[model samples]
Target: MRRRRLRALLGAALTAAIAVPLVAVAGDASAATNSFRGVNWADARDNYVNGWVIPSGLTAADSYSTVYTKANGIIAGFQSLLGANTVRLPINPQSVNDTWWASYKGAFDSALAHGMKVIVSYWEADTAKDGYVDDPAAWNTMWDRVTTDYAGNANVYFEPMNEPFGYSLSAWVSLCSTWLSRHANIPRGRVLISGTGYNDNVTGVGAASALSGTLLSLHFYGFWASDTTRAAWTTNLSNRLGSYSSRTVIDEAGSPMTTGLTYTGAANQDGNVFTSYFAATTDLTRARQMGIVYWPGLRTGDTYSITRQSGSGLAVNNASGVAQLRWGWGL
Candidate 1:
């Protein structure tokens, strides 16, 4: 299913490009940061691709080894294509289980070894399980373990949850508050909470006043799946969050669809999508948005994977045209 979805999106992208030439105009290089600009390591249209595990046919050690190789390769490729400085690593607590500490420790070590900043996202049970009613005790316990183990590690950032889909505003506030309270022991200013799904705009940030010591995180993909409902949501979010001085970042963004429905060109309609997102960042430049992490950096046959159509493996392909845009935008 993942593979098929990627193929369809890639087809659409190719069809759109046929009618319009994809050009990446160079932006101001001065905007780059030590993480992205000065060091030329801005945020990336990062692939949520994991390499800590491989297929069943491989031995456990071999699996880790092979996955790490591919993972590092992908990171290098993205840095080259988007001039990105960081990669968001999704860590499933379930996968760690009884060996949670050991698994994550190893994963973090590997990420640091690759010279990439690690954004660790905690995985919770689905909404059907309990909505946002996560066991606060369990969550705190896990964080304690991580902080104690990785104290003073500059390359690590914690994402309390991913998307928080199906969760209400109050539920989100509660979870975020609990997570922030638990971070007293961890290094301050290294944790971030991912915004609500399909509506990462300001309205989605409900408890901005309550959250402390963590940067506000949100995702963007307005061009591909969002509609008027999402637009209104983002507008409300912008208005509500505009007054607050809290730092904000779009940890994730970019369109992975190949449907030819862009904001420019004949079929293009999502052109303003990226520019609008960038405009939102202008207000809080030092807020350190990091950069936009593009999904599916490889054009694999998945809805979110960035694998390409010509079997070009896991590297970013210019054939997508979006890659060029990312580079030009300094993402």
Candidate 2:
């Protein structure tokens, strides 16, 4: 009788072990299917060829001022032409003390007005005493304020920091985790963690996994000086990051080095090099990993501005560049 009872107990334990795995597998499959459900621009036709740059200013009323209206119009025009659904705006944490919020608020409002998604970046400053890196408490406060102001708004994404290279990988991971934990009240899928490398390549999957539900962001600007370098970088990145297979986005990328000059002369040639590099990178297999955001749509003093020269009459002559972006890749 004792031997028979032990056998039955062992059999019951074995059955439960098998059942547990089956149930766990089913749950994982279910979760995978729902991973990207309801995320904005997830199924959009175009690969995310979003643009980034500083707005002309934060103040001018729509349709009234030349500078502000033109800045707003340029972005609106791009969305109309390209069906771009996202825009990345870098927010200097130090500038929050001044009218930076007011200046950018209009642009953010305009993006919403035109049905475009907004990704706000918290950038570090060189000399500022109160930037995001300078004060942890202030950073949290700013995040709270922004989220409170724009909470429940559609298609708005938050990036806690922009290219936090000075901090160790572990430190960055910790900082991002803390920020997300503190803002648990914010709507889900609104905050993203961005890293910088050759192409925003994350150093460790462990670090990436720490981000619970936020998007993984990266920046890639292969040698802006030459197309060959750009191509190599793109291929390297694709190979390195292809295996992760997580929800990723190229938050900033472009080839031609922008110097706040006319679109013609040496600048035009450099821009073409960038365009060709983009074309080559998109053709690679890794391009399928996630969305690609082109850099600097209308801002000057950046390498990836796509709009025409600020005061020069020369129209942005890269129609093919724009066309390639619209036709290539999936966001």
Candidate 3:
């Protein structure tokens, strides 16, 4: 997730960008887009750290074997309780090049072993959280190493970066083009180009023919709007998607699941801020058959977390949230 302060500035840029529409290139999107029924497993400090990142409930002290064991259990909970078939995780240059990667790969291996599609996304470090890549050399090195490691793994997908809000559309597109050309070994279908700003809109990237074969990642939040009805929210989302729904995956859409808000029924959703947003977004996902991944499936201290750690096990924080999520997946 991106910081709200950043959103305040970038949101205006997004509005201006939207004022001038990009022509959507009409083509068939891979059916794989809808096949992802997933959730993000985020770090407690929000995945942007000064050094190595440790996912919530995981310690840097853990060995490879321990990470594998813990990740397996958490993944099992996602499958049995929420019916998730995919998981999105964060990575940074520091985490990838350091020794922690040896142990972190255990989590990916465990998830894949359990038949989960893993999306490993890059997150900028907090020391320079200006929404741009911290270091071009380090960033490219991280991707080179990561792509080399997972080139042969069909279950593992690579997302260039998470919420790249600093670069202009042309500059961001140029970076993505460079990335695609550099790592030609990985299949384009396995690469996800994030939306223009804060991963908020896909129309710009969708129009780029160079990025045609790749999937698009989008993020939405209830706090971004005050639409009272499902229809209004749907319009807001559709405007951003702009004929790219077939190829787009809502990789990060969430609300407060642990706040005792009901997620079912029109009466419960209509006037309420959180419920209305979720209802409209999920309803649209089901309609479009687009892939939708809820934000922070398990993040310590996050009220939006759908699952919580119970002793050594994992449990649902809100049954209704899971129900609505599954409904979006058409489960």
Q: lDDT order of candidates, best first?
A: 3, 2, 1
Name the 10 consecutive residues with the lowest summed lDDT in model 1.
Answer: 37-46
Off by over 4 Å in 2: 1-54, 57-71, 128-132, 196-199, 203-207, 224-231, 240-242, 257-276, 284-289, 301-303, 309-315, 329-331
- What is candidate 2's TM-score against the reference? 0.68
Residue pairs of candidate 3 with colliding backbone atoms: none
Count of backbone collisions within predicted model 3: 0
Which model is ahead, 1 or 3, in terms of TM-score? 3
Instruction: Give the Cα-based TM-score of candidate 3 against the true structure.
Output: 0.96
lDDT of each: 0.44, 0.48, 0.86
Q: How well is each residue in 188-251 modelled by candidate 3, as lDDT tens digits?
A: 9899999888888888888877787899998888877777888888888898888788889999
lDDT of 3: 0.86
Off by over 4 Å in 1: 1-67, 99-107, 125-138, 165-167, 196-199, 202-207, 223-246, 257-290, 298-300, 307-313, 318-331
Clash counts for the predictions, in order: 38, 5, 0
TM-score (all chains, Cα) for each model: 0.61, 0.68, 0.96
